[model samples]
Target: MTERAADGTGVRGRRKRPTMLDVAREAGVALRTVSRVVNEDPTVGSHLVSRVQAAISALDYVPDERARQLRRGVTGTIGAAVRNLTDAHPVLGAIDHNAREAGLTVLAMSTEDEEAREREVVTSMCRRRVDGIIIEPISSNHQYLSAEVESGLPVVAVDRPLSGLEADTVLSDNAAGIGTAFRHLVLHGHRRIAYIGDHERIFTGRERAAAFRACVAAHGGPLDGMVHPGAVEPDRVVAALQTALGGPEPATALIAGNAATSIEVLRHLGAEAGRLAIVGFDDFLLADILRPALTVIAQDDAAIGRTAIELLLARGADPTHPVRTVTLPVTLVPRGSGELPPA
Candidate 1:
């Protein structure tokens, strides 16, 4: 039966997966012969092999690799636990590409930024005996993974360090990025720069917010309603915007903490966004097309991805080697918003 969505619209079900039995029937051969052919048995008659190969080509039958890997005792698979798989994920693509180059396949799962889900997916990957795991950690305490790490399961963290474990970590230079944004705004003659971002519980959020504070302190600016770090909801962002722009010490410039915060600030400002000098941390798609074009600090994603795979392989080869943390530098892309004179 066809499935229907909650709205009563017809929705397609999963495609009917072709099976080995289907291949055997198509080739007019026994199921054991099909399995032997798939396993590349040299003793099988060449004619039978050719016939099975032809059937495989005609039906596009892809043999399951996991069962074979189990028999061989090494999966040659690494698992990736990213924040979301459904969203735009350039980093995840890079990781996959690099892993492929290393003769390894990647199994990616989404954590949805939930600690419980992260743990569940990672544990599931372990149960399947993946060779290694690369994680964008979200949990407050990852003591659960200590056992796996101790047992020599190669684990590498991307974007944030794993809690309660000393594993290989790859991070963007958050402090340098924030400093670049702050200086770019300051060079344009703006001293009262406001910031709004995610709650400090998140690693990126904490690093960015702290970096912004350091910038403010170094410049000796009044830390009034300028620093607002909390949930990324619409209400919280709007409230922060109001506070920064409404007070007697209203800010003439803004530095957004992340890509999401940059978007929220732009949405709230609308036409007025042009009047205020702005610099954002983390460039996003279409940032160049926005009015006055957003200036941002962009991380080197390709390098980060490649380096992550390198670290994972290195850890696997020599577990006794000292664990390493790599912090890649960020670049500043100035379009127009960040260069505007204080208004």
Candidate 2:
């Protein structure tokens, strides 16, 4: 039996385990080259690969999964945290499919737009040691993310900005889309326009709000009565629209912040939908089926998801690379509603 330590611990002191460095030293190659071979990086030459393999066998060294994860600061798994999984957001599906094709597993979680829940979800992913993360941030706590990034983990913000953290991001051009929507309404002689959107704390929401304000001012429209933010839920958006349309001079047209909001606004209008013109940010399934097909500033959600994963994979493989932001353009689809005349 192995002798116990002086402290009366049952376990005896063993020789320190041989690490990748020891293998690299014996293999006569740089630490990075050994890491490349271990990771199956194609850049490693055959001669170095053979040497590393020979050294690993001679030393009888067993690769430590936990140590490897710690050394790379990655778990070979990617995490995606969204607002909801059942929202039928095409982007979620795209993310899952693309990640699988890239030889990376995706662990998706939903925060339901709650800050506390969001924090919990992030913490859980960290505990699992995900290789990287792509998130739709819910709040302005950018400092928390900065700490995570500082820990050598690669993070990318999708559909939003990480308030204060310097990280890679992939998002739609919200300002351009909003500007396009506003201009479309104005071109149709919509002087009284109402904008309904999500909470301002979200990066996309803020950008949409800013663009709406700027466009209204640039087009010489009334910015005061034409702006309405913080109406994300269906019931809230319905109520907001009812109030906006009930005013002394109701809006001639409405601009929805997203597809979900458009659905709510349309439901609120019901049979009166034909009476008011509408332009929305995202395209929905039944948009073309409505009495007057909905006009929308459509974004490629799937592409957004794919691009985000690509960015994360690139960065994860090369931590020393500079962070990048990839912005995809939005297109405005014209339909009967967008061409409606003022009330």
Candidate 3:
């Protein structure tokens, strides 16, 4: 006779799970010997190891990895707190690959770009006793992590730095990339270039917008009605685009601050996009296939990931060392769109 599930969902009852003691009884060996064999102790003789293995196979027994890891005082897992899970996150993939190569598992959780969610996810990771943490910060104040940091938890910030806490960080060179985009547009005979980007409250947004201002000042271009730094919303972006292109001295070219802004600008322009020269910061999926493929300042996603893992491991190996910040370089990928002449 078979037992039905407690909820009467038609799922069959499970067999009595086998335990370590059952394995020992089956092998006719002491419980301690079975424990040693399961733990891979080299001192166990060959004959005993073979007998224990046969018994384990016959009973279909599985060792409790969580209990074993607890006894060893390390979980062999790392936690990654990132912005979202729905997007194509190449950096996260690289981090996972590198962590696996180092014999560690990655427990990834999305923060949904919310400070409260970030705190909840990170706190849960801490409760699980993860060996280290890699975070893409969304919080304006990370002082809540001070206690954990002081207690020797290894934390590495990626893409952006933690606001109030000092930790190892990996970042792309934002200012330099902005400069490259501005110069690229200038080289193509676009003196009246406009800039549209993320909100100034964001770290990258602030850096890129400041860099654009500096470029315009140095080149003697009119700054008025040209630089638009605000929320990346449809209405805001369209208004900014109109202001840049509507005036008598309308911009001949545009530099988009980020990938989302670039897409927004293009979506607003439609078939008219071909008339204006454009350069965007940060590449995105399917960008290369757009008509007049997007020219972009691309961050080195793989390097960012590899370097993040390296920093994480180094932090774990020597928690007393001074915190380090590594800023990787960005590259300019010129496609058809950025090369268009002023309309």
Candidate 4:
């Protein structure tokens, strides 16, 4: 049973893929010369390139993408494992831009803030043999990646650190952001401030919550019924709000942890939102158009993204380099809401 491919390769059912060695043999050139020619290395003489091209044409030698990548010691592509892709993420866009400028492609996957999903997405990227990985770690136990890390796979954590694993991290200075938010409210005459954000189990949530508490202690303000760190659900937020506003000493200011928390707090507050001094962490689109305009402790998305890519590339370049944790600065965007005096 004899057959032929389009290039006239003899085959029965499936034709064997041609290797670079075959190209070298057909070209009567050294393997390294063929490699240089295939990679378009300018150092190769014109005659050598012509010979290689002619041989490639004759043997129908199609170089395997993975083989070329292996020979070059890089895949020229990175994997981005972020929280989710369903929403608009400026950080992801920045990462893509930076990666493109470095002559690399990006493959993005969603973790959805689930530990299992995060592991699956990241491990899948590793199996695919990506050059490096940029991860928004939702899993608390990243010891699973120790083998890959030891193997010199550059893993950079964005938005949070990988627990049980010391990897390059890019954070948004969460404590500083929270402290700034609190001061902004205090300057506006908010004596009693309340905070509701993501669960304390998460690193950002823990950092922000601790910073808020520190602010209260420093200002000699009451702490009772002022801090709420739990799930960002309507029922939980509503209950926390009721507790914060109903006690003997009601909170005059509110600080929502993340964008989702801010939206939920606003939705629950309804008309009452106008009377409360509010500050949120993490800025999103149309944050300015809200009725009272949302004041927020905005993470530097561009800086964070750029830093994450930088860390990933650096780790790839020098695996023995000490893992660094970059804490980029955050900003307090003052709008009408956070500037309001105590109600």
Candidate 5:
């Protein structure tokens, strides 16, 4: 026996979705009158609007927004392709907040930091004909988006630029953040400082590691066994820590390249974390609560988000506008960890 619906229909028990025709029939009005009422045409009489609204309420009608948006030749929604949805993403939150304030909707999808997944998610968004797109790009080659872009689709890249594509981009000053972290350690009387960060294959990791090298050169500090850039995994971070701290000329201070790497370094250091002057590149939640609270170079997550939306909207408004890249600044927050004397 087939399962029955709440209305006891015989054929698979699937209830048909109420349509505008049903609403019009119930209201004793023509189909065109119902359509005009649904669209909120200014010329529709108040009495007819009331009758249609009552019929709609009686049938619990829910309009198909996608259909209406298609008929209007535009969707009031934008798509956001981000790295991941599992972690706390302040930038994504800001994007959603700003989008709502602009009378737009955000449809977010996670790419899991994979190149193939980024392509798939972005392609899906394009197929859905979203008004615009904001992406935290992970792919090495975004030429896949060329056709859509050429066809006037607005795209904005956040945190990193789109490879092989010219589009609007928003970025934090990665090199400056690293420089500030290095200088902060030097000011704290640390002559021998080591840097550990994300893999150099990543854009941020490359910029930050290069900046650290520049800082070391400017200070005439030893570069040998000082810069360690690689994956942020536990085993790799532990090995890098050991190498940075175990050399004949061990470093007295350290700069973690990113928040995850900083956490891994702190976890490995345990109670010994206070013995070394440390500054992380990115600020994270509860960083201030740690013993000898973590010092960090903090990125402006809100500005990045808001700027991305602004660029996206601008592109949508005028596709012929010049492609632009906006780089925001970072701040150094002094805490106990980065101020420790060389030990």
Candidate 6:
């Protein structure tokens, strides 16, 4: 007997639908023995198991994943939310790749840098009832995340720590990275240093700015020339740079918050790029190809992504485990631009 699929493709006409019964018959074993072999049961005798497995393979038998998932009470799907996907953000790519490798489907959504949209996306994922969630939280309120955690769904934060949420997190050491950049500038005889960054509402930006202040204070340097916050847009950052550069005693060095900020600083420092020293957090492509090249604090975005997914999956497996916060280290990559003397 045979069955045909909707497209007239032979479902069983070409070859009989191979089953465990067929494997048992071919191996001359009981149905239970075939089941044990198919399940890779450790109690099964090695010799008999090999025989049944060979028969199953020869018959092209396949296990039903949907049935397995149903029996396990899991959907085999994970939901992930990020700020943007088009940036080829290394972290997002890693999480997506790792989740797929672990046999979990990923539903990705972008918040487009909007907090309200972030909440909407998260709400949609919750309605879909994903097995777990990995979020790059757009806002400081962890209340939104608490709902998921309380519902027994595992949630992992990536890149930034959740402000009020008690959940597992994977992020780079933002404070340490900023401190290193500040120290490097100070070591180069830059007493009047300027800090330019994003809004303090974000954990990363806040930590970086705080670290810069602490480092400068420790060296008896005045913090009077700090630029306005939340200058991610190029125009805004350029304006801030102009204001900082026109200070009473212009800043001898500038510590940019991240890659986006670095772009603006570079544009403002064009032509005389090698004159004013600058150090940026987060390395970007072709950093070394710029006129004077750029020095940066490099975070392992891919590593952060991979670690967050693994942690989320582990938590999903055992929700009762203690919550952990994993902070990865950042590296300082010195280049010609950050080493320049005061203009």
Global Cα RMSD, each model: 13.1, 7.2, 11.2, 8.8, 11.2, 9.7
Off by over 4 Å in 5: 1-75
> Model 3: per-residue lDDT, tens digit, 205-298?
9989999999999999899999999998999999999999996899999999988899999999999889999999999998899988999999
lDDT of each: 0.83, 0.79, 0.85, 0.85, 0.85, 0.77
* Clash pairs for candidate 5: none
Model 3: lDDT of residue 300: 94
Model 1, 60-88: lDDT tens digits are 88654333332232336789999997766
List the candidate 2 regions with Cα displacement exceeding 4 Å. 1-75, 145-148
**Which structure is stronger by TM-score: 1 or 6?**
1
Q: Candidate 6, residue 24: CA error in Å?
A: 38
**Residue 114 lDDT in candidate 6:** 78
Local distance difference test, candidate 4: 0.85
Off by over 4 Å in 1: 1-75
Candidate 5, residue 57: how far the Cα is off, in Å = 41
Instruction: Kindly list the per-residue Cα lDDT of model 4 for residues 44-80, writing each as its tens digit.
Output: 9999999999999998886544333323433367889
lDDT of 4 at 92: 95
> How close to the true structure is residue 251 of candidate 4, measured as C-alpha lDDT?
90
Which candidate model has the greater lDDT, 5 or 6?
A: 5
Candidate 2 lDDT at 20 equals 70
Judging by TM-score, tell me the better candidate of 4 and 6: 4
- TM-scores for all candidates? 0.77, 0.78, 0.78, 0.79, 0.78, 0.76
Q: Any idea what lDDT model 5 has? A: 0.85
TM-score of 2: 0.78
* TM-score preference between candidates 2 and 4, better one: 4
Report the CA-based lDDT of candidate 3 relative to the real structure.
0.85
